[model samples]
Target: MAKKKQTLFECQHCGEQSVKWLGKCPSCGGWDSFIELNQAEQESLKYLSKQTSSDKQKAMPITKIEEDDVVRFSSNNTEFDLVMGGGIVPGSLTLIGGSPGVGKSTLLLKIAGNLAKSGKKVLYVSGEESAGQIKLRATRLDANEENLYLLPEISLEAIQNEMLRENYEAVIIDSIQTMYSDKLTSAPGSVTQVREITFELMRKAKESRIAMFIIGHITKDGSIAGPRVLEHMVDTVLYFEGEQSKEIRMLRGFKNRFGSTSEIGIFEMTANGLESAKNISNRFFSSSKEQSGSCLTVTAEGSRALILEVQALVSHSTNPNPKRSATGFDTNRLNMLLALLEKKLDLPLNSYDVFINISGGIKIKESSCDLAVIASIISSFRNRPISRESVLIGEVSLTGEIKDVFSMETRLREAISCGIKKAIISTKPKGIVGIKCFEVDEVSKMLELF
Candidate 1:
């Protein structure tokens, strides 16, 4: 046999590499990321075989490629399907990231059961959990997946070989960080190993037209497992965002190539498994029972809109600066809103300890929550109650102006569906069907409406 040959390239970011023409990269997603290094080498047969491994690697005109019409798979939980933009696309790759004990594996196992029940072949490759452990959890979930297959393996080559031997319809790789390839000298979870393993799976997925769901661990900074490029290589990215202590879990799709990325799914975690909440709007507003400093807000996640409750408590501060804390939302954003409240309306937030919460243990990032945040603070300071039937959606500017938000139409419709009669939005009333509407450009004007 001839000697093996190798070619190298410089990483655009760190100037270290041994590959060429990688968009973004295994290390980073920086654009035009690879620079080839010319080297004298004999034409090799093995390297050529590796390059010709998949039909998806063939060159084709962009116009000739058909965008796969998006399809939905029954996630067993309607809410999960909604978050997945109707359903999981065939041959698509999904990366689900979350903290430990946040139920990442459990959620995927539940989905595997659903897929297997729907007459699809599902292979669950567990690099973290044991075969018996998954079965025990499956028993608790009451899942009936006679077609589901389980493989407790961490080696990438073994999984790839097994995949080629069968005609599985779907695959789930539990925790990508744990899986490794023997071809790479780097240890598993290292930058090189993660990249190699992911590429192997990607090649397999694209060639087989089988969708793959890979669960990932979150770093201390709450980023998905492995280098950020793992997300760029995948077709869709999802995050299971919610507090573990709370029964409510929010599944958010941050990116989707086959469907809308703006969708969100709401589920309540029960001892059995995640169950879909049909009347999510009603569930959000049900907690508002004449509670002081509690207000309703309409926010949009992906394509789906929702009404969420914002709760605030203002107490006399023993600390000179007062404690400004918030949960299920950004604390820095909360502080800026407080500053705007004080500057625009002369609210005495400096003397009070302000705490804000997005009820139901779900995080809200939409700027539309600005109005509700302001209203909650005011209500808490005044010890007053906000109208239970009213909801607010707007963004607060640094100069105390309430700005127009994206997807106002969707937000308004969600409010209406939730039985909200009055809405305070920042735009001029444009005659949306149903419900009373008030518009204000600045927070000062909004204060007058309340």
Candidate 2:
């Protein structure tokens, strides 16, 4: 008698497995995402699991384990290197994801050229674009280096064979979703194919000490399009943020095994290609004449301090439900601030439709801009223009108390560099020069400054 074959179903979105098919995936809440695996795919999954389990070694004492020395090399891009934790680590797998036309492919191609110019043998593999298409881009980016080779192939076996044929130091995969393993029968970009390809690439990178960069497409929700396991297997995860119409782009790191993830890399889209933006201190805020409904604030991004402008618009609403909208800032926090203003300042904000915006394409994640938000809203309501030389750097609480934010001194220094003369905060720091500071402990006291 022949042996019975086992059946399994998996979620395409999150790789959740079940013994039987279901209408919706219980793990990821995806409707109708369960697909039954073929015999070949099922067997491949089993073999992969067994191979991983069999490789586990016996537990050893912590003192007996030896530490591995970490080595890094520059990718020749300052902003790229900064986001990659100083430099690129050999045998590291990095995944880059972003919206369409956000400069993911352009940035990597430029870096590949830089690496090739530095005398490192590099391979640029594109499963989506042809060799001629990439060559045209390379010409525009000035990335047509002698050592930079392009291969328009999708077969994993063929790619592996080519890698064996050459001594390439770094590899770039245009996308992980486009690559498929012959061992798996599922379609390319499927959950199984992505997982299998990533695992193989990771193993190859570690065994050969090759640095690999894989581009991934993001979903509608801005997450990488594939199983969650794809992110887990990589050493670092980076996301490109900026509208295509805008010239400024920011690369932020979400995960890193070698360095802190707080650092962000800023780049500018020019006629040539994406270049690092060195003088970005004044990029987020304008130095123009003072206007009502606009206020300046300083917030910290990692080790760097950024001065951003908070803009608000207040108008009487004819509808019973006043509209509330915020762009590049949290809407819920804006509502909370509006409520706080109504209760604390006796301001009739409930009858007005409030809108808030952060200047530039940058998003404000920290609460240090709360005071500035309040100031902008009030300035708009009163139709009074705030002084452009003054900066606000504090957080407001529900009890109407002004709270000091972290890195207050750093924020003040950035503001001073941008020609700011005054700063309103919860407390004054000792021995600070250049910018004058005013202390206000309560929100009611803060309104007096206006």
Candidate 3:
């Protein structure tokens, strides 16, 4: 009698493995996401487990280990380099994900062209698009160069063979989801196939000392569509953010071993392609005629400070439970601010509908914009317009007191550069020459400014 084959099931959502089929995954709480692995996939899993567990290397003292001399080269795009923590490092595996038609392909193609122009051998591989299709795009992007080669292939084995044959310095995989491996029986984009292919590419990249950039498709929830381990396997991870209808796109770094992860790269979509925004400081706010329900605030994005507009609308509601909506701002935080206003200022906002919006499609991630949100709400509720020359910078506390925020000096400097004449902050800073500062300690005190 033949020996019975061991059964193995894996969760498609989070890559949790089990010896039997499960209706619901305990790891990610996903329903009906577990699928039994094929014989080949089972063997692959066993091999990987043994390899990882049987590591022969021993731990050494930190000071005894020799440091590695990291090598980096610019992609010739300032915005791209900024998000990448200076530049591209050889043997680095970078994964970029974004929504469809968000310029992932366009941006990478342009960077490939830049590398080629700088006399570096570059290869562009696509599993979805044909060579002719990429060529059409290259023409629009002016990426035609002798060193830039296009390969319209999807097989991982074929790509590896091509890389082995050529002495290319950089490679671009149009998408990782479309690539399949012959070693695995699973279909392309499946958990097993994606994990195996990423592992192989990572090993090959390190061995050949080649820089690799792979594009990933995002899910409906705005996360990269693959096993969570896919992100852990790469050296860097970047996400492209913005609506296709908007001209401005922000590239944010989530994981970067080479540099700071807080840095953001701003790009403008144009006829030529995605280019660094020239006037980034003045892009998020308007200095036009002052209007009610609108206020200016300064927020820090890594090393750069930007002046952003916070808009709010308040109106009487007939329903007992009024509607509370926020765009580009946290809805939960908005509720907290509303409750704070009602308690501290004795405002009758419980029967009103409140709406908050951060202008220019920019999202506010810091609490420093809390004061601006409150100012905008009050201005709209009272039918009063705040001056555009003034900016609100502070964090609101639950105790109805205003608190100072980080990088206050940098934020005020940016406000001054945008022609801001006055600032309302939690605490006034000394030696801020361009803008006059006023301190408001309590929420009730902030209302006096209007």
Clashing pairs in 3: none
lDDT of 1 at 96: 92
With candidate 2 superimposed using the best TM-score fit, by how many Å does residue 145's alpha carbon deviate from the native? 1.1
Q: Give lDDT: candidate 3, residue 194.
A: 85
Clashes of each: 6, 0, 0
Model 1 stretches with alpha carbons more than 4 Å out: 1-77, 427-434, 446-450
Q: Please write out the lDDT profile of model 3 over residues 1-450, one tens digit for every residue.
A: 999988899998779989989999998888999988989998877776675575788989999999978879999998899999999999999999999999999999999999999999999999989999999998989999999999999999999999988999999998999999898887898899888888888888888899999999998888898899889889999999997888999999989889998889999999988989976868777798899999999999888888899999999999999999999999999999999999999999999999999988988888899999999999999989999999999999999899999889999988887889999998887788988898899998867888
* TM-score-superior candidate, 1 or 3: 3
lDDT by residue (tens digit), candidate 2, 1-450: 998888899999989999999998988789999999998888778876785786668988999999988889999998899999999999999999999999998999999999999999999999989999999999999999999999999988989999999999999999899999998888999999998888888989999999999999999889999989788889999999997878999999999988989889999999889999976978877788899999999989888888889999999998899999999999999999999998888999989999999988788888999999999999999999999999988999889898988888888888888899999999998878999888888888767877
Model 3 ranges off by over 4 Å = 1-3, 50-54
* Residue 442, model 2: Cα distance from true site in angstroms: 1.5
Pairs that collide, model 2:
none
Measured against the true structure, the TM-scores of the candidates, in listed sequence, are: 0.82, 0.97, 0.97
lDDT of each prediction vs. the true structure? 0.78, 0.91, 0.91
